[model samples]
Target: MLDLDDTLFHESDFARSGFAAVGAHLENRLGVSDFASHCERLLKAGSRGRIFDQALAECGHHPTPDLIEELVDIYRSHKPSIQLPRDTVAFLEHVAGLPTALISDGPARMQRNKVVSLGLDKLIDKIVLTGEWPDGYGKPHPRAYGEVMQWSGRIGSDHVYIADNGSKDFIAPRALGWKTVQILRPGRVHDGVAPTAEHEAEFRIASLDEISLRRVLAGSR
Candidate 1:
């Protein structure tokens, strides 16, 4: 089975991109004043995933790909402020024995950097970058998930995808009969986006440590 970003990593890089855009917007428009301080606070308070969206709403600015890239560079330079939960490493160790895949979407180079720098390659079975694929259709598109399953020779129903983002990013896999796990990170305020009531996986956990990897894949054996 494969796990999504939050199922393995603590922060969501894509979500941070949104907040980075917010920061860039502030820097561009507000000219490095109190607005910068406010932008930092808003980004820090959130789980690093939805900070940009919240900040954009507050600053009344729209996000662009350029702004997102700038944030990625800044975030890569200064990633110390964010704390990776203790349970994350422990869970990775726990599942190290199983045939696990780390599949993620977003900037391919950036995600690959994270895998190498964070020592993820030493732990997981494989790291699948959607952007590296020919189609480049990200999750919720089904093609990415299909590619992963095909590459791994694992059937759709045998894998579990976990992410702490919107359902649209994952709706396709759920439709294909893969199990889903929504990592309930704190401060993820819902803006009327709801989970798909249909085929909503077998479980939901607040932390990866809460679920037993051995139990989930026992069926495979």
Candidate 2:
């Protein structure tokens, strides 16, 4: 189980929630109208150290470790209305008998808040956070899957990873021999990269509750 944002929770009026907080913080400090652009670049560049230093230099503020840490703290403090999704809970309850895992990439505390909020800690068999170990990297990287495989004591082919993001998360897992369930949530899109003719999945599901392990692992396709 990979969390999309808050996993079971959806922030009400999510569009305007914490975006402005970060934007305002960056705009004031960086003197850039588009702080989000810089932030995106920072993250996409694998949190490049020098880019952040340059950002600080541009702001006439020397880069300090504390400043960056504070920036992350302020960002995390930006609250979103987290309302647990009933469907997610129902899915977790239904799949209680099967081995399950929650793999996510984010700060330990913040992600832990989300997991606890959803009571997922009690439900999942394993909780794998890439950030907790040296093998930390975002999805589409096999390392995250490797950690999950380690915890579950299962080979990649034995697990079915259901995720909403097709390219970033599902693609590598599919290639690594895990079955994929593409969740069609709003705002999630295929990037016009069609699945290869040779790429076949055991199943595709809209929600976690819709899949049964028997059907998924039985060579049902």
Candidate 3:
């Protein structure tokens, strides 16, 4: 299985795409200039949870709840301009014969759009978007991993999950007895170390190019 966002592609690319869309909307509708650049600057400065609001403020516009919500909708619904890195493309081809799955957490529309934009639907066999399920079924819940097991008809050690975020990406798969590998790609958004041993992946690599398919299938750490 695999995780979306930083695992398969640079999530910052997606963010920039969304910010561009939002900025275009603001410029076209509200005459807010350079909104996208402001958002990107805020993100580079390590701002989180308030990129839109701060960007609006920086652009001399008061951000109301409705305006923020509108911007978010525009950001999430826009067609993302993103692509898989060459390494990721080669890695997927390397495992082409395997039963591949993608488990991602986000709003269904947004995540689905990403999958389509990345052409992942043509490459992956199964995909689970946690947002399609009820609350509490997201990462650390093990629900999506179980679904993958059922879909692939694979048990415990036979399943390997390649993902990025150690905080939540590895927890459910690890608990389910599936081998986990964390790919710490450059420019990834989540760079925090796991809080505990159980929260960490069994193996770690810098990129998908570093993965060994034979060893991965053998569940060798």
Candidate 4:
């Protein structure tokens, strides 16, 4: 299994595309020519929380509730120009024919937009999402792992999860006995951070290129 964000494509790339979409949306509707500065501010803030409100206030707009909702919808649903990194593409191909699944955390729409943009649905065998699961169980929640188990019909040693954010991504999978590996790509936002012992993966690697050394999945050795 895989985590979608930094594990495949960098979230920062998505953020840049979304910010440009936001800038274009603002320019088309609100006559703002210099939204790039506001975009930079939100990037520094990270997570893009309340970014529409921030940009609107900067533009002297009152940020009415309806307007904020509209802009937020635009930002989250934007079809981003992003793709799996080259090495990631090669790694996925190498793992082809495995019962590979994608288990990720995010709102259904936002994450699905990414999958669609990257054509990941064509690559992954199955997908599990917090929002799509019962009671909306995100990562670090065992139920999320359970969903992957159900979808792929694999358990414990039969499953392998490769994710980037060790802080939360490995917790449930490790607890559920799924082999876990962490891939910290260079230039990624979460690069250099160590996972807590509670979340530490069995193997920690710098990039997909290192994955060949760790391939213990059923006869792939």
Candidate 5:
């Protein structure tokens, strides 16, 4: 299995794409210029959860809840301009014969758009967007991982999950006895380190280029 976002592609790329889309919407509807740049600046400065509001403020606009909500909708629903890295494409090809699955967490529509934009439906056998589940069923919950097991009829070390986001990505899979590998792609959003050992992946590599089916299967055994 695999994770989306920074695992297959840079999350920042998606952010920039969404920002541009939202910025274009603002320019068309509210006459705001450079909104995307303002959002990118705020993100680089470590701002989270309120980039839109802060960016609007920086653009000299009094951002109201309604306006912020509208901008967020635009950001999430826009067609993302994102693609898998060359190495990621190679890695997928190397594992083409394996039963591959993608498990991701986020708004369903946004994540679905990303999958389509990345053309993953043609590459992966199963794609699980955890957001489609009821609340509290996202990563670290084991629901998605268990679903993968059921789908592939594999259990324990028979399953290997490759993902970023060490904070929560490994928790459920690790507990389920699945081998986990954390890929620390350059420019990835996650720190690739968990707050505790229990949350960290069993193995870590700097890139997907380092991975191979033989190596992971042997290590899992």
Candidate 6:
């Protein structure tokens, strides 16, 4: 199985995509420059309205209800510009015969947009947007893991999960005895901290460029 977000692609890219469009939209609406700076601040602070309000304030513009609504709509629904990397393509090709699954956490519409945008649906055999689950059974919850196991009709040693964000990604899979791998990539959303020993993956790789069948099998065992 695989995780989306930082594992398959730079999640920051999605934020950037949204921010780029939002910046441009704001510039056009407010006659402003330096929208990129505002975008950076918004990303750092990590909220929509408060960041939007702050950005407008910093830019010496007044926030209007209509404008905020429009920006939110655009940010949520934009055709995201994202791509599968060459190394990830190679890794997928290398595992052509294996049944692959994708488990990601996010709002269903947003995460579905990402999957479609990146063509991940074509590359993966199964996908579960755990955020769409009842009560949001996402990472660290065993529900999503259980659903994937049901699809594959396998459990325990039969499963291997590759994901990033060790903080939450590995916990449920670890509890289920599914071999887990951590893919260390640049610009992870949750950076700097490592997973706790109980939640940490059994193996780690820098990227798909380093993945090998041998390493995969070894980690699962």
Candidate lDDT scores, in order, read 0.59, 0.60, 0.90, 0.78, 0.90, 0.80
* Residue pairs in clash, model 5: none
Measured by lDDT, the strongest candidate is 5
Residue 127's lDDT in candidate 6: 85
Off by over 4 Å in 2: 6-72, 78-80, 134-136, 187-202
**Two-way lDDT contest, 2 vs 5, winner:** 5
lDDT of 2 by residue, 1-221 (tens): 55545233442222223335556776786664655455445544555335545555554667689777766666556654354567777877777788888777666666666566556678787887666656537665678787777777877778877665444666667777787665554333222132553333346555556677666666574
Instruction: Quote each prediction's TM-score.
Output: 0.65, 0.62, 0.97, 0.85, 0.96, 0.86
Provide the clashing-pair count of each candidate structure. Answer: 2, 0, 0, 0, 0, 0
Instruction: Report the lDDT tens digits of candidate 4 across residue range 19-124.
Output: 7887788789888766656766666666346766777788787889997787778878889889788888998888888778888877788889999899989998
lDDT of 6 by residue, 32-55 (tens): 777657867666665544666677
lDDT of 5 by residue, 1-221 (tens): 99998899899999999999999999999999999999998888878899999999999999999999999999999999999999899999988898999999999999999999999999999999999989999988889999999999976788989999888999999888888899898766667779898998877887888876577768842
Task: Give Cα distance to truth, residue 159, candidate 1, Å.
Answer: 1.8
Q: Which candidate, 1 or 6, has the higher lDDT?
A: 6
RMSD from true fold, candidate 4: 3.0
Q: What clash pairs does model 3 have?
A: none
Q: Cα deviation in Å at residue 12, candidate 1?
A: 7.1
Candidate 1 error regions (>4 Å): 1-5, 12-37, 44-84, 133-136, 188-195, 214-221
Error of 4 at 169 (Å): 1.1
Output the number of the TM-score-best candidate. Answer: 3
| Poorest 10 consecutive residues by lDDT, candidate 3 | 212-221
Task: Give per-residue lDDT, candidate 4, residue 99.
Answer: 77
Off by over 4 Å in 6: 41-53, 62-70
